[model samples]
Target: MKKRSWFAVLSLALVVALVFTVAAGCSKPSKQPTIDKIKKRGVLKVGVKADVLGFGFMNPATKQYEGLEVDIAKRIAKDLLGDSKKVEFTAVTGKTRMGVLDNGEIDMVIATFTITEDRKKLVDFSPVYHVDGIQFLVKKDSGITGLKDTDKKTIGVAKGSDTQDRLAEQAAKLNIKPQFASFETYPEILAALQSGRVQVFATDGSVLKYYESQDKNTVILPDKYSSEEYGVATKKGNDDLRDFVAKVINNMVSSGDLAALKRTWGLGK
Candidate 1:
């Protein structure tokens, strides 16, 4: 009976030891930093605009994304994954960009997103990579040369952008009240303007230039409303990624690479 009991005790000890060995081997590693996660995945996911020509646009002919923002995302991917082509693009508008970043659909957003105090509450922003001003795109025949002539006129803007607020603030200074019509995308706003549904389409000057290029009938007003500082946005609490993005932007600015990129896309001015 003693011998049998000894054997049973030895077997139970071995079983517990084997279970512990397997558990240790199967335990997950500690949480990985965002950069490491990207490296492991072998691709960086970026949210960008598909319609803004100079910044982020999908070439209809090539059916591929290209623009200043797309290049920047590729550069980041190269830094993180050792291959610029290891980046995936997800077309995003002002309204959907933040949602995708928040839901983990993309690692970051380089979608001509303006940095603002209110937005800083939800997502961390890298340093300003580009600065543009609000402007109006009006039909050549509309006779609207500037904000002074926009009183009581309807201006179209993107639904989630700050362009409307900027216009309101500027118009208040001029004692004018222009009606606003918001749309999901810049193309829709331009369409509304073409249909005479809205007399003006207001957005960043760089973006307005693209629409003006597409339609010779449209002209961007010379009056600059407000300066918008564009930044790369990362999920809130992802300081590591944000800092790395900031470093890349700072390097670009210092090396004149950002300006060169702008010139490549016809946004030099």
Candidate 2:
């Protein structure tokens, strides 16, 4: 009788212990330190571009950021935290993306960040989320075919953009020095070109797509270079976080989430 009662109490205690353990496991993600941190904080901080329309932009209508990068970040947030709304977005630019990521102002950057040898030195990159390339945006009938035709003509690119370096490299190959006009943002460069302040908007084709769609008079010069592999970025030596992000990206690609997003944004190859 007494022995049966003792066994019943012991069984109850063990069942309670098991329940708490399972609950703890549910509340906290196991393994990766970065994943654990994110779970503890209950939110993911992501850096994204605010000016580029298709890639990332703050929609004036909703007062919320929207676009491919934003969609990617939201999907990742949903996977990590079980809710897409568990994300906080910070606007980053060509000049500030790496700086803000390095400063820990954001846990990850999905801001059309092109993977490059130089950028690899500063931070780690997840598997490529999008494949883009650099191209020249010129006016219709402007007679600019490629970099060889620049001939010291003014080319506009965002300040701190790798486009400047790419243009210089092309200039070296062509034996011509091209003049460059720099703006602080991608939209500003487009504005400069539209207003005839610069003859060309030379940057990523993914970015120029917006203006090309809006204005029929503009044309992409039909020359593509610098095969840009856009990746999510994390701080240097953050291999754990990088790996986790890479897994999320892989899942997104596999589950057709990313492909659906590309269609939603009207992003084509």
Candidate 3:
């Protein structure tokens, strides 16, 4: 009886050891961060502009976001999430773009955000998808051909845009005092110009073209204000996500999709 009891005790110990060994070998560590989470969520949260005309804007008639930037976001969603319609548009402005990205409110920003060194410190930018220059829009009859002509006239600019700073620097060079009136968005600036509240509105040439298409009475002056490049903005440290986005943009650029979209939106030659 003693021998049998000892044999049973040894058998139980062997079983417990085997079970632990198997558990340890089979256990998996937690998953690392991946684009898979975004795919699983079934939505690509894209930050965009709601009133930037050709780049990103909402069509009230259809209640859908449409434009070059919107198309780019849709392509990214289709590539990463397998559905072009899986994008949720979050309207963003220059002042709020970085804050919204840092707060994780959106996965990426496809707004017409200019890539600058200061901005690069806060977010990662995909490859330059579009190259443009700042320009001015004035009444077709304003007789203002360039900033040089606006010696003492009022100029409308968005509060947080690079245009505001560029205009200031240009005014200093010209030794002119510009009546600087700030608005929250490009549309607001455009409204101010159309209403004769401001003599000029400064922004990217592509954006000016968009506004001109909507209202033929407006004209973009044949003057280059400042050079700028537009790119996709992702939170800093997301190297994987940033690379993925960059790859998509590069592919689009090579495959003629970018050019096609630009032409479709009346932004290309």
Candidate 4:
């Protein structure tokens, strides 16, 4: 009888030991770095454009930023932070966008940033969200059909934009010395072209179409300077964040939300 009691007690002790071990293993802390800063701050800082039409800009009457890119950023904030209203918009220009992202001024950039090998070296990009091509915008009466006809004309482009690089490369290839007039924003470039400050405007074909829609007298040239893919940009070395953003974007695309947003914002190709 004593042996039986001893055995029972020993078995109980072993069970307790096993339970303790399992509990310890289960209670181990997660290794992921804390994302509490965003929650505690009660805001998700997002970089967006204030001048680029259809992509990011403010509604004059409502004084709210509304655009396809802005909507995507808001959706991301909603998924991660539980409320779309938590997004705080920061106006960023092409020249300052990457710098602001690298300095941690914003958590992510959804400002029509193009994905390129050179930009990828400084920041991580989510999956290709939109496809575009560089094209030329000219006056309807200019009779300029393509880049080949744009000899010695003043061309307008946003400084620090991918279009600027494409224009430089195209000029180099064609051995054309086209004069360039750099603008601070897309609106300025459009204005410069419309006001005759520059004879031509070079940018993504989609953006050129947006401009042409606003002003019926503008024409987009048929020749494409280069193809580009747009993506969400985050600070470098944030692989986990990049993966999360990419998953959300892919889901958005698959579920037709991205297409709907593009149509609503008049960004559809």
Better of 1 and 3 by lDDT: 1
The best candidate by TM-score is 1
Q: What local lDDT score does residue 163 receive in model 4, on the 0 to 100 scale? A: 77
Superposed by TM-score, candidate 2 places the C-alpha of residue 161 at a distance from the truth, in angstroms, of 1.8
lDDT of 4: 0.84
Cα lDDT tens digits, model 4, 1-269, are 99999999999999999999978864565455424566778788999988667888887888999898899999988887899998999999888898788767888898878999999888899998888888888889988777766678888888778776688777878887778888887778888988889989898887777688778899888888887898999877666668778988999999999999989987777
Colliding residue pairs in candidate 1? none
Give the TM-score comparing model 3 with the true structure, all chains together.
Answer: 0.82
Which regions of candidate 2 deviate over 4 angstroms? 1-32, 214-216
Show the lowest summed lDDT stretch of 10 residues, model 3.
Answer: 25-34
Tens digit of lDDT per residue, candidate 2, span 1-269? 99999999999999999999978754553344777788899999999998778778998899999999998888889988999999999999988887788766789999888899998888899988899888999899788888888887899988767888887897888899888888888778778888888888988988888778777889987788688899999987667788888999999889888888898988855
What TM-score does candidate 1 get on C-alpha atoms?
0.87
Question: Which ranking of candidates, highest lDDT first?
Answer: 1, 3, 2, 4
The lDDT values for all models are 0.91, 0.86, 0.87, 0.84
